[model samples]
Target: MDRTARILQDLYDSEINFTIATFWHAGFQIKLGLGDEVNGFDATGTADNLVDAVEWLRVQAIKKYPESVFATNYRR
Candidate 1:
């Protein structure tokens, strides 16, 4: 598969739940949601590339849930 497909597959396989939207002529936006039903948080990141967008969202997720499995596994 191509790089974009691979990255998307990896994201889908991860525990983190997210949605991505593409702008007409701007770029891309990703909205990532973390935490359980009782406690939840949402973060949005926009970038010209998917990698940058995911990285931005990942940083936000790590900051909010430093001890979470997603953060721990992401570091490795």
Candidate 2:
């Protein structure tokens, strides 16, 4: 897996209050969450293209971590 893929996998698998891999819909900075309250990141860069990143992540996750989607949704 590539670096980006690894980060996103970690995010989907996270159990912490703050996961740095949690990115808002932008370039890639980091999404902040206090308990169940999350704040959007003010991202700016080439890395924050989440629309494309999400599809890539979903594909990789389905292949490697099929159960992660449930975990991800539960986190919401």
Best of the candidates, lDDT: 1
* lDDT, candidate 1, 1-76, per-residue tens: 8655554555566666666779788888777765543565377678897778767666766666677665675654
lDDT of 2 by residue, 16-55 (tens): 2222343355454333222443553222123356555444
Worst 10 residues of 2 by lDDT: 39-48
lDDT (0 to 1) per candidate: 0.66, 0.42
Q: Per-prediction count of colliding residue pairs?
A: 0, 3
| Candidate number with greatest TM-score | 1
Error of 1 at 43 (Å): 1.2
Model 1 misplacement above 4 A: 1-14, 35-41
TM-score of each: 0.62, 0.28
